[model samples]
Target: MNITIYDVAREAGVSMATVSRVVNGNPNVKPVTRKKVLEVIDRLGYRPNAVARGLASKKTTTVGVIIPDISNIFYAELARGIEDIATMYKYNIILSNSDQNAEKEIHLIHTMLGKQVDGLVFMGGQISQEHIEEFEHSSVPVVLASAIEPTGKIPSVNIDYRQAAADAVAMLTDAGHTDIAFVASPLKDTINQHVLSGYYEALEAAGIEKKDELVIEGDYTYDSGIEAWSRLQELSSPPTAVFVNNDEMAVGVIHGAQDNGVHIPDELEVISFDSSRLALMVRPQLTSVVQPLYDIGAVAMRLLTKYMNKEKVETPIVVLPHHIEKRGSTK
Candidate 1:
């Protein structure tokens, strides 16, 4: 037989209202009463009816998370963190992939809203002004995870890409590598631009002349990485070191270099951002910048919960810290 709130209240010798307060995690009840009610609840194996509870509170207790690509290890780990926290808070998550398309993002947002999600978490390349305007009219709260727009009006959780990239480049330059190449995704995206800018700044600071021929653009894909590596090798003078934007492409670059009879960390050193599991799977292993992807997702969910509860959050925009993981990929 399923246990009910009435059973918990009767067992605890408290009124139904007191039991309700304890179950809802309300702090208004006395500690003794709360403890007693919790004991009764645990002993009886009582489970709160989420649907009824939501109706009574006028909240769905569901958060919608929209990520650019679910298959990507970065987003996958982030979703795991978000789901873990949501479960801890007795909330469910509705997850979707947007493919980093603005139109798809917009459509997913509307779909999630229509589903009556109490809050939203979005992760992508760049959220446009039009998207922000549309969200402003949304009744539910929305938070950005691992994404940032220039306006800085919306709440977001991300690391300083520019600084992280700069640090990576600086590490190579410090290792006596003057011929360095930056392999990045499309610079049209805001996040990619920040990383590229960091690379440029680091090179300029190191007094290393920027070579247009050395910079290669990839779509953050393994195939793109291979193609970019081929193109870079075809150049009259190939770079001694390469900094890739992501681990997937970095792996591709490594393989491409090997196929071309290049030795890692000797003939060609490679490093990338996003310290994913793939970093360790490689032969020499990839040295990468570790972005707190899970923390970003968890914190974004927490902030969205606060917003849903009408609570004041200290900071709307959260910049998480990142660090480089030194490995065999770079000298």
Candidate 2:
């Protein structure tokens, strides 16, 4: 078992705060008490730096990063930013993919914490009550990147997902497209739910009634986008435009339409979230909501450092800015 400051404090019959002062050479501690704490720390082979390294000029601690899917371009970009910032801070990161599985995610949390990571940065689609509880009870600070916990108890960084989705759908509405379709991801996660809510809100604002047939759910994959197109064509009156939840699926929708001899931006307008590289790779480049993936990860890692250092954070929950990037996919 890895010994921690808590162990040293318990053995010394002192508070963790008192043990901290002794470790940091604070003059406020009584000399006899400090000597006793030091003895306990030495006997227990406790390394204070692992728990409290805020005063150190050079940090060599490791932080854990939990990503839903590192293979996805969206999460890959976010991870890149996190890695760069971790390098700059002289800290290493242990990255794990949960595959969006609740049990696996919970397991990873316990395993990483057992390793005594100085902090944690998590990115996932769903944040369950159990996940929040684990994070709250964690010995190390936890920071969320592009994830939401409804209780707002955990520190996190994200853009206004609802507003961003609304903005994307509104663009299609502004183009006088009333017969619009939404290619959405699974609504199990709050993020996708926010996107779906925005889509409906935009239609309502444009005085268009929500059509049950016009909405199709995708699995955030290119293949799913293709499959969604097949479903939409089965409708008697196919939508004239589509708002996709992510760029990969949007590209699939575009290709699927083109394969059926449909002219993009002329026959069907398309807009998607996550202006990732996939957006620009297509023939008629995708118009997308700029989510600032890298920035979100970088900011999240920076925020984690603040908590690890016990620094005062003015805003524990950070909301970044987002905008629409119009391209050939949208008229």
After superposing all C-alphas onto the true structure, candidate 1 shows an RMSD in angstroms of 4.8
lDDT (Cα, 0-100) at 44 in candidate 2: 86
Each candidate's root-mean-square deviation in Å?
4.8, 7.4
Candidate 1 residue 311 C-alpha distance from true site, Å: 2.5
> What's model 2's overall lDDT?
0.92
Clashes of each: 0, 0
Judged by lDDT against the true structure, how good is candidate 1?
A: 0.89
Model 1 spans > 4 angstroms off: 1-56
Per-residue lDDT tens digits of candidate 2, residues 1-331? 7898889989999998899888877899999999999999888898766534543523337899999999999999999999999999877899999999999999999988876788999988999999999999998899999999899999999999999999988888988999999999998988999999999999999999999999999999999999999999889999999999999999999999999999999999999999998898998999999999999999999999999888999999999999999999987
TM-score of each predicted structure versus truth:
0.84, 0.83
The candidate maximizing TM-score is 1
State, as a TM-score between 0 and 1, how close model 2 is to the true structure.
0.83
Clashing pairs in 1: none
